[model samples]
Target: MKKILLSFFLLTFFQNVVAQTNLYENPNFDELAKTHKIIAIVPFKTQVQLRPKQMKDMSAEQLNRVEKSEGESIQTAMYSWFLKRKKRGDLQNLEIQDPRTTTAMLKKQTIDYNNIMDFTPQELAKILEVDAVISGEFETNKPMSEGASVALGVLFGFFGSTNSATINMSVHNATDGILLWNYNKKVSGSIGSNTEDLINVLMRKSSRRLAYTKNSKDKD
Candidate 1:
């Protein structure tokens, strides 16, 4: 019985690892990156697939609130990750706008985060006064406790429980509002997985291809 259970667990784990998907990455990203002096990481559109128990317990309003919060959390995480990387010299002359500033500006404009998707990318960039924008959608198959995830990551680097999430990140030119680069990936979480870990994992895989970091490899 023990052997059977172990085998099954291993199979499930491996499946999770192998099941991660990369949907697309724009090829002309480098050209776009070079022109960017500042970029905004906007709140993502979040779709949480709640468990049956959660559906029964949570009201629609509660769910909507949580979803909105998750979008901001993800936006902040992505910004911090890029800031750290840029500070570490991985990204040269790249600036990620402060989330607070973005929020304030948007609020003054009467733009609600929930209605962000309705705006054109060009319009958003102009409002934010950025060279480009990084925006995307986040989808998750499980309920995640954001605080618990961060605590676990800080205490134990890798031994944490995980859920599955997918992200579609795109960069748009502030001038033309055209998508300059895009990347999509499906990732799994572990006990130690936090927002930072997730963003780091995704960025490491995609950043080399990102125009802003094209010279990162040659820097050392």
Candidate 2:
């Protein structure tokens, strides 16, 4: 019984791991990243699909609110993950703009989150005064809350949870409005998971392939 249960657990974990796929990557990612000094992480676009029963019970307005809030949470998570990695010297020459500052500047410019995708990457990069911009979109099967996310790995022993997400991340050059790189992946998260945990896992895999990181040259 013990062996059977352990095998099931390992299978689930590995299944999730294998689901992450790279959809796109730029040929000149390294050169482009080196040329751009600072990068700003924009708020992610989040979409949640509630279960049939939950959808029947929850109002659309409530779902919209959760979606909008989760966007900001994910943006902060991305920045924080990169910042911490940089601080620990795990990332070299990769400077991430503070998410607080990025949001504040966007607010001051009267840019609404819902309408953010309408804006060109060049315009956003110029407004943020960053040499490069990082943007992403996330789709999840449930309304993800920071607390619930953190609780998964923390309380549930790093196994068995209900969250599944697909994330698409991109980088654009400020000066020329060219997309330098992009990465997309599908992930299944655990019960005690949060935005930080999600982004941390994604970034750990994706960043290794990104340009400007210490190990970029060594990867090829």
Candidate 3:
């Protein structure tokens, strides 16, 4: 009996490991990241408003209240993941916040975001003093169905959009904002019927496609 139980446990554990695999929509980061050094990941932010749609069963005021919480919740999760990844420190000289936050400084120097494009990556590399920079974006159905109040996103659709998320990401050289590489993925439809499940799928797929390795994926 002991031997049989042990075998079952081992089989279950191995099956669990194999079940955890990434389903990346685009899987080419290995080639691009090989050349670059420092990478920064911006937490996902989107312009999509979860208002007007979720108003089907609630007053405008009610929907607004729900959406306010939704954006903050998703962003918080993204930032937490970013910090955790940073701690792992796989890449070199990574910086999360942009040195240049405000456009006012550029105006003071009479520099245009457009005009700056001509500068080469080597030059920008010299200016920012970093090997490379990463840019990322996210859009999600937002949280809802917390046992009581639905997350912010569902309230956006007429009766709550099947709670989904879409993510688009790219890596660039700080030097002149060159698009060294990019990746995009969307998790919605019947495959993931709601927000919570959508989050699970995105993380799983990204981990695999991001390829910290073939089987294991680093948060960073």
List the global CA lDDT of all models: 0.74, 0.73, 0.44
lDDT of 2 by residue, 37-75 (tens): 688988888887756765576577766666777788888
Better of 1 and 3 by TM-score: 1
Report the Cα lDDT for residue 44, model 3. 34
Model 1 over residues 12-115: C-alpha lDDT tens digits? 65555533556454566677677778999889888877667655776777677767777888898888877777888877887889999999988888887779
Q: Candidate 2's C-alpha lDDT?
A: 0.73
Clashing pairs in 2: 149-192, 149-193, 149-194, 150-192, 150-193, 150-194, 151-192, 152-191, 152-192, 152-193
How close is every model to the real structure, measured as TM-score? 0.80, 0.80, 0.44
Name every residue pair that clashes in candidate 1: 160-190, 160-191, 160-192, 161-190, 161-191, 162-189
Clashing residue pairs, candidate 3? 53-157, 54-155, 54-156, 141-164, 143-151, 144-150, 144-151, 145-150
C-alpha root-mean-square deviation, each candidate: 6.8, 5.5, 9.0
- What lDDT is reached at residue 35 by model 1? 70
Candidate 3: Cα lDDT at 140 = 46
- Give the Å error, residue 41, model 3: 3.3
Model 2 lDDT, residue 39, Cα:
89
Model 2: which ten-residue window has the lowest total lDDT? 151-160
lDDT of 3 by residue, 29-91 (tens): 465555555443322334333444344656655544444343334434444454555566633
